[model samples]
Target: MPSPFRHTTPPEPASAAGPVRAVYTQLARDFGITRAPTFVVLSSVPEIMASAWALMRESLIAGDGGRTGKELAALGVSEANRCPFCVDAHKMLLHATGDHALAERVARGEQPADEDQARVLAWGRATRIPGAPELTPYPFPAAHAPAYIGTALAFHFINRVVSALLTERLLPGNVQRFRAVRSLGGRSLSRTVRRHPAPGAGLTLLDGAGLALLDHAGPGPDWARATTVGPAYAALRAAAGEGERLLDADDRILVRETLGAWDGAHPPLAWDGLPGRDRPGARLALLAALAPYRITEEDVAAWRTPDRTDAALVRLVAYGAFAAVDRIESALPVRTAKEAS
Candidate 1:
């Protein structure tokens, strides 16, 4: 099969070494898929790839929460981000949870008949709105907040990278649109979806990478403290922050100020304050942060000189995506210890 990757050489499982190989091995074992386009697109940068996998593994696959609820949250977040690939993947995972009827409802864009589940899905979608009331009094239990919120956040980053870097086709010919294919894909992953590996397993994959960033993550959000989520989130934050180096000091400030004030609404094409193609780096970074789906071939060609490797391009996009991550992180509800507990 042709690689889904466009801008870089895909990592080889057979020859991958150290952390890269370890992540691939664990992803296969824990995620139950041989070719995850989502993770492999990131394999060009080992730390970023591992950090992303760790965040997803610890929070969504291994963290505390019902798989059904987490999967719904993931699906909702994907929808909010306009990531068709992740949306399909999560809907299929919902099928793997043996709730095919509800998966069908979500695939059809219908609200779940169960009101609580509907609210859960709504809460997930509302996440992109930043500071929206739907985020507070979280639809799920407080104790499960880390898993639910972490899962939402993990996808918030993943969806951006996926949307910007890869095509929307989850499968060749985009056959995932067919119900039978989605169910089959879901069935293949059922066992893994059914099993929640112990938390902190993904932390090992970070090894050298996450330790330095531990202090940077601070105590984590009030909702996710005392859990494995903090380290993974920090590790990813640091990894993606490397991309900031791609932009100049002035451009960096511009991107940050723009994203910081964003109200979580998607902007229209040709909106003001966006850098022109003349400043391809700033333009690409902002688009990746705000509306990655709008990135066009010319936008990339303008930035990709023969001297620039795929790794550099990936980091640039990660910088933009992480800016959005930072913006959303600030607006997230902050509860005190007593309230969190």
Candidate 2:
């Protein structure tokens, strides 16, 4: 099937070269799929690709909570974000974990029959809102905290990327829904998903600030730390670049101002009151920041021109995702050691 991405194309599973090559190879060897559509779009920037893949692998796939719990968390986030791509992917992953009945119920928008599964799903949905609940007496056990939070955050970043860059179509048509097709899809990931490095494994590459961010919220679980660093650094790095390629001087100021004054709520943009509403990149940035789930093709159509390359869109989206992630992270109730224990 032809790709829905207009800016970037998926690299050949065998054909990817450079920094992404090693990561792609590891994904193929470990997970069965060589190039995930999400990672493929992220490959527009090799650094983003490598960093995102490592963080996601450590937190979601390989972290403390079981795959079933993590997929539930991911599903909650994607559902809140209204991202069909990730919703379908996680449903497939749940089935891959050998819970076809539960997967079907979730795919059909039913709650899981299990109580613990229901709690996890509830927490994930709550996490999408700014300051919705406290982490104290978290629904799951302390050990599972990192895995759950990390999974939510990772998809918080990923759902945005998918919504902005990729199309919603999982397969050419409804073929993605066929039992045989999704099951075969599940088989491919069954092997590699369980092979991730132990959660909280130290990252050798992080600098002082990066390390501090991981450590800032106290001696949290390893998976949580890994999850925080991945999105935080990736967002900061994207900000360091020439995002101006999309938003001009005034548009940049508008984005920063809007985000700075944000109250951690997804408010509707009074398009008439917003700055840079006329510029597609700026409009996309605001939608990503305030109401990412609300972003539509019209938003993209407004900003994209012959000159706006896929690379630019990727960076712009990354910036908005990080902006929102940063806000959510700051408002997240910091867990104390006593509370964590």
What digit string (tens of lDDT, one per residue) describes model 2 on residues 1-341?
67756445555656766556766765676556777788888776655565556556666776666888888888888887778888888888887787778888887788999988887887777666767763444667666666566667778778877876788877778566777777777766776665555533323212221332233323333335434434434433343244545677888887877777776554755555354537777778777666665667677667777777666677777777766666665666647412554
CA error at residue 73 for candidate 1, angstroms: 0.6
Tell how far residue 17 is off in model 1, in angstroms: 1.0
Cα RMSD, model 2? 4.7
Superposed Cα RMSD, model 1: 1.9
What are the models' TM-scores? 0.95, 0.80
| Best model number under TM-score | 1
Q: How well does candidate 2 score on lDDT at residue 217? A: 27
lDDT per residue (tens digit) for residues 68-100 in model 1: 999999998899999998998998899899899
Show where candidate 2 strays beyond 4 Å. 10-14, 134-136, 199-250, 260-277, 291-308, 336-341
Worst 10 residues of 1 by lDDT: 209-218
What's the true lDDT of residue 52 in model 1? 86
Residue 39 C-alpha lDDT in model 2: 82
Report the C-alpha displacement of residue 139, candidate 2, in angstroms: 2.3
Error of 1 at 3 (Å): 3.5
